[model samples]
Target: MHKGNFKEMYLNTEQLDLGKFKVATSETLYMTVVSMLFVIIIGLILGLLLYNLGKSKRIGAKIFYNLLSIISNICRSVPFIILIILLIPFTKALMGTFLGAKAAIPSLVISAAPFYGRLVEMAFREVDHGVLEAANSMGANKWELVTKVLIPESLPALISGVTVTVITMIGFTAMAGAIGAGGLGGLAYQEGFMRNRPTITLFATICVLVIVFMVQWLGDWAVKKTDKR
Candidate 1:
């Protein structure tokens, strides 16, 4: 291709409206941030329960742990696109529609939470056993042990894990867009892919990369600040 043609291919904005681009970007951000909040909260709770239950000698706890483990594994194993389709009814019931940015949040949270929950469990596992023992000797109750000891000690890893999870969510947002979720992904699919406008797709991909890079930078900063060791 000639230089002029290449320039036109990328620089042509006649079909790619700036206003729509801005809206798509905002929608993507909204979906990612909102879904991430839920993912973190739910994932943390699931992780804590899994860890505590797995450690208990009680048969009931063990049975519950096994059941939870199976569920988490199934969720993590499902493909994101299939998961979205499977969740359409739930999303519609919850949001009253399954075709917009808001509707995508439920699927995003459900898809990511189990993955993040496993990461949280790993982070909790990495906490120094010696420190836990010390806390136990000091008569730290279960709540205190979790709140003050486990979370604080595993914070760096937790942050790092969340960084990865957030980036994954960013990608999930794009996939959500494919089905009219109204984000960069939708823009890419509808305008770029379906309409044969490669420039728009390229633009959307670039925007996603920028968001991922920013998240990575911020996550690294947070990990460094929190990692006292």
Candidate 2:
């Protein structure tokens, strides 16, 4: 539907004016959930590997850790926007196109995984050394140490880190909107700036701020519930 000037856009608060925005919000939520799942899963794996390597005394472990460290640093060092544009071709190859929520996953996962991975490593490291020693005295294997000791011990911090990662990823989704990923950011840009509809833009901004606040409150509550210390 053709929208008139800003005044008409504000006066006409019908579904037609909001249809695309609703779709964009759905797309944004889908992308955030999927991307966050990838981040958590992949980050846990990488973090476990790094933590093990750091705790080991073997030469091969050191060599492998160095390489992994370099890779993780590089991924985190590059700005998100540059990473998205640079990886567009790869994302397209992976998802069949460099637009829409699906296409945004590659860059999101690539960037977010390393970020969360660092947190994971730190969380595990924060586990008490005495508990680790006790586990070792009990003849627990590496798997047992991780499952029964490291993970259980570090869970509170891990939850907090993941919460922070989720909040960060929400912002990333907005940035991804600039590349046709269809989110609040894209809606604000297209409808507000391009079409000069401040009402739509203000509404989009409010939606994002609300989401961030909701996520933060939920995260804090979860963290408090999980934290026994």
Per-residue error at 89 for model 2, in Å? 1.0
Per-model TM-score, in order, reads 0.96, 0.90
lDDT (CA) for every model shown?
0.94, 0.87
* Model 1 TM-score on a 0 to 1 scale: 0.96
Global Cα lDDT for candidate 2:
0.87
Cα shift from native, residue 1, model 2 (Å): 31
**Inter-residue clash pairs, candidate 2:** none
Q: Give the per-residue lDDT digits (tens) of candidate 1, residues 13-48.
A: 776888889999999999999999999999999999
Q: What is the clash count for each candidate, in the order shown?
A: 0, 0
lDDT tens per residue, model 2, 116-224: 9999999999988999999899999988998998988888888888889988888888888887887887887776768777677778878888888888898889888
